[model samples]
Target: MEHFSQTLARAAERKGGEQNLFNLVSAPLPEQQLLAQTDDRCLAIMTKVVFQSGFSWRVIEQKWQGFEDAFWQFDPHKLVLLDDSHIERLMNDTRIVRNGQKIKTVPLNAQFVLDTANDHGSFARFIAQWPVDDITGLWLHLKQHGARLGGNSASFVLRRMGKDTFVLSRDVTAHLIAQGVIDKPVTSKTALKQVQHAFNTWQQQVALPMTQLSQIIGLSVGSNERQV
Candidate 1:
């Protein structure tokens, strides 16, 4: 496999320059700040990622204010307490997407946030305590424990919330394949381990966050520009 520095250099050339490449990729928040986030903020991100799955992100972005209002700013305590009437109300509400199944996930995810908090002092703390080197492990945890937080949705949630993690998007997966990190899409436990090890190595060697490394690899493979 090529050294990660070679991969990043290739990406920088394609993106115009290193600065340009850096400008496109997002930086993660400090550990303290990440841990300081309230349960509401975490739940809001989870809800947004959940709703964005299999739907147009533009539509979700346009209706985000409505979502905030409908979910009472995603206050986990209040959301967990909502009854069937609340779900029905949101299902009929025009301001949001009005998808019944997605709407139902909101309260379930809210309770997940609260339940995690109840066990770990706070949801933010639990996530913040997660080691970035084993980010896929965290993703697995989300899939197992959180509602509607499977696959890339879990990664997107962490990325949106300023967590220092990598996403296995199609583009990124392509680059990983090209770099001989994996033979196919990351799915099986062994494949995910290979991907994680590649990222962890790159991170340690370059002193860059997994988020930046992931984006750089994606760019190297000509992936569409996105806010990583």
Candidate 2:
């Protein structure tokens, strides 16, 4: 395995200099800021991520306002009351994407937000208090408790919500494999644990957040023009 310093050096060299590389790395939000997010916003983000999966993100962004309006601004309390008829109506709604399966995830994930909020005061507070070193645990929690949150969905949601998380993008996974962190893609629990341990080791060496560390590793390889 390569030392994180070597990885940082290679990333800087590829991107022109350390300053340039540093500019691309964004820090996670402060704990208070993350905790300050409303539960409705958390549900909205969950709905957005669910819709964006296997779909064009740009199209989702373009139609986001429509989504916001159609889903009653994604209020968990309101969304949890949606019935089968409501879902059928949304299937034909022109505002948002009409995918039935993805549309149905809205109320399900709303309940997830509500349930988590009930336990932690708010969903944001729950995520904000989750241990960054055990981010995979949080990922599992979302997968187990939320609808359609398996695979990269949970990670993307956490990253989008300003929780410090390392998304296993293609570049990041390739870099990890190249460094012998895992012999293959991280699909199983054992593989994910191994990847977590590696990231934890790197964190001990460098004081950077997991988000930036993952970005640096991603930048060290792959197309230089691609965003981490």
Q: Judging by lDDT against the true structure, name the best candidate.
A: 2
Pick by TM-score: which candidate is best?
2
lDDT of 1 at 93: 91
Model 1 lDDT at residue 148 = 87
Clashing pairs in 2: none
- Cα-based lDDT at residue 84, candidate 1: 91
Query: Total clashing residue pairs per candidate?
Result: 0, 0
TM-score versus the correct structure, for each prediction: 0.94, 0.97
* Candidate 2 segments whose C-alpha is farther than 4 A from its true place: 225-228
- Put down candidate 1 lDDT per residue, 150-179, tens digits, no spaces: 879889999988899998878888888987
lDDT of 2 by residue, 50-84 (tens): 99999999999999999999999999999999999
Count steric clashes of candidate 2. Answer: 0
Q: How accurate is candidate 1 locally (lDDT)?
A: 0.88
